[model samples]
Target: MSPRPSDRRSFLKTSVATAAAVSVPYIFTSQDARADEQKSSESNDRPLVGCIGTGSRWNAVGPNAMQLGDVVAVCDVDANHANGAKKKVTDIQSKKGVQRDVDVYEDYQKILDRNDIEIVTIVTTDHWHSKIAIEAMKAGKDVYCEKPLTLTIDEGKKICQVAKETGRVFQVGTQQRSEMGLKFLQAIALIQAGRIGDVQHVAVAIGGSPTSNSIPVVDVPSGLNWEKWLGQAPLVDYRWAKEGKQTKTRCHYEFRWWYEYSGGKLTDWGAHHVDIAQWGIGQNGDGQGASSIEPIYAKHPVEFKDGMPLQDDRYNCATNFHVKATFDNGVVMDIKDSHQDELGFNNGIMFTGTKGRFLVNRGKIVGAPIDELKDNPLPENAIAEVYGGKDPARSNAHMANFFECVKTRKLPISDVFTHHRALTTCHLSNIAIRLNRSLKWDPKSEQILGDDQANAMQSREARKGYEVTV
Candidate 1:
């Protein structure tokens, strides 16, 4: 059976009231969209979508778009990936007895140049997230960018500014926000409801970043735009390798290990865990973040000078570290590679409060307080409430939210402003480790107080012809 009317209203009231009190512009309402727009699903008048960056992660989201709407264009710096994605979209439509002609391109801007596409999915590498997202907003398309939202702290401000100026729907792909029964939102609900008393400390345990030795340079593979792949990043020769055949250390999944293109595990898993941690603590929206950040310990595979890696051959991000941050309200947070010894958990958040504590992860939720809720669990309307009254068991809930918001002009649950705020903490953690020092952050000013060198690292110089601007 579905939830009752009163139960639905009560569930929405929790998040909606909090959103309203803070004046979040895109909170859901009964009149969120025109009645005619809601009928698009029945009439098959779905939005046109374009997929950019059809890498492995992109594979997860590409098919979901096909389920919701027509994917007419696919783009990627790697020709093989782009063409492969186009074929996938074409096949999906054919199976539905619909003939489609999906176009393929290497330059993403070509897809943006088309005025007919209404939505764009950006699953590019971390460094390219903000620039492409900003440009897409300027092109008047609703965007679904995967996390972490920005490569540096400065990119966060640019993304938020452009999103507001355009008034378009911008959703960050943090699926944990919508996964029903994951206990992420449930944890937030309990904290907001005071079931855990005032949250004293939150421990986030994301695993250590990968380490790699210097890789020998190799020739660029055919059908790949090596120059475009390195867009905005300093030009470096390709390092081609495969398992036994040719082990290329800098391509595909290995990109996460390098600081030049991504922030390693700090932004990888940290994006998901840290984002949830901040949300539960009531500090994820605009102008909300830690007041101070301290890098207690760190280790790296390469040397560093002035916060930049000195070597060009090996993975350079911190392999292991612990960062401590304090909020303005005196809430303390510990972000580390693991907490197995300290808390008997390694890949989840441990929220310690005055009355009780609990641990939450993808696998399970465990603790005395949660155990006490044997039969008296979260209300039946909780899933719908957290999802803005939509079905919680949706196979593509995160992408579904983005598509609905595109038509309604309402904010997706994982809005850009909040994602940027959460990502800011992750970026700061990387910076603190690179600098090997503590930092005083002024959340109001969004500045690293009294530290000129650290503040300078907030942004990097984009390569010529690829500079990102607001």
Candidate 2:
């Protein structure tokens, strides 16, 4: 039998030292001695990896994880997805002139049980992120989990706690932090150097949450494990349409539109853009967040009570919302959907301060402060400082950094604590919209002050047998 939660936690604490000392290194053979030497010069130590959630989003991260280490196994609730990912990984390895066979599994616990696997990349659904992450940490594997890290504030907190207690190197997949030549880092560096001149406001545009009319339940896809996919979430009928038509709202990409599984764009893109905004505004740490969140304006497809959508068939996340959050430092943040006249990028973050403002997205960073950088550039080591002394020029640097930390035993730039804090802001915005009212927050205590119902929304009771054990 798999170890119990308490046993796993205790094992993690006791076994970490031994595990690190004797961890296996994945070695790849080369066709020639010269080629072998070249590969050896690249890195002698490559950790064994197991990827969970081999779906659409996993396609990107799953491959990237391979670039950092050897993937020995793959897991997914969908049999087709799991098999497809296995083939992809095998093909990639074959192209690299390496002969490797990857085992496929439907249960993530099977991957965690292997003493050979040292790292786990979690690309599962929002609701499964926290449970799998905490369990993986207890299983003594360093983790690289995709963001928005958890389904709710309570989940995020548990993930953070378990990570801390396990002393595992954890990296959240908010790749924007390590992507695009570290543009977000540059923006934050400018802000910290007083370039933004005592910033007063930050505008983050993550697009609108999804909205859909009531969807009809349909048959479950042939190879999908509907029950396991809905782990920790209320068991509902599997919904999908025939091959061509838009079927039920519970499959693949459509899952993001529902409140039961996700927080819509609020957590979908909000996890990315809002995370950057909080980092830029210096509210990206535990006990550092908005002091008050006011729902300036909001609208949803279905009516909600006690911060939950009343209907399960339709997309319930707010489709259109504009919330104003004031931090303890008296900085105001406007998080909203794109508008015709708003001064921000469509799916990016914009920082507004007293002196000047700048906007950054995947494509570019622009505005007056950025323009000024033409004459006065950031310090040469700015990005290095941001990345905790790791070289930012490495290919797929984010995953590379995680691999490095897996060896060095250091925290990655995108750690869980700060991520949870930023996600709290996004969660707060959604809660305010669900209630269509303003709410006060005590950042230090991480509570919705004077609002019991609102505070209660910070967590949800998981379905039996799937509860996330911290």
* TM-score against native, each model: 0.88, 0.88
lDDT accuracy of residue 41 in candidate 2: 34
Model 1: weakest 10-residue lDDT segment is 24-33
Worst 10 residues of 2 by lDDT: 21-30
Flag regions of model 2 displaced more than 4 Å: 1-44, 242-248, 339-345
lDDT of 1 by residue, 189-250 (tens): 66766667889999999999766556755645556665567788876656644445535476
Error of 1 at 420 (Å): 0.5
Q: For every model in order, what is the number of clashing pairs?
A: 6, 1
lDDT of 2 at 269: 91
Candidate 2 clash pair list: 241-247
Q: Report how far off residue 440 is in candidate 2 (Å).
A: 1.7
RMSD to native for every prediction? 14.1, 9.1
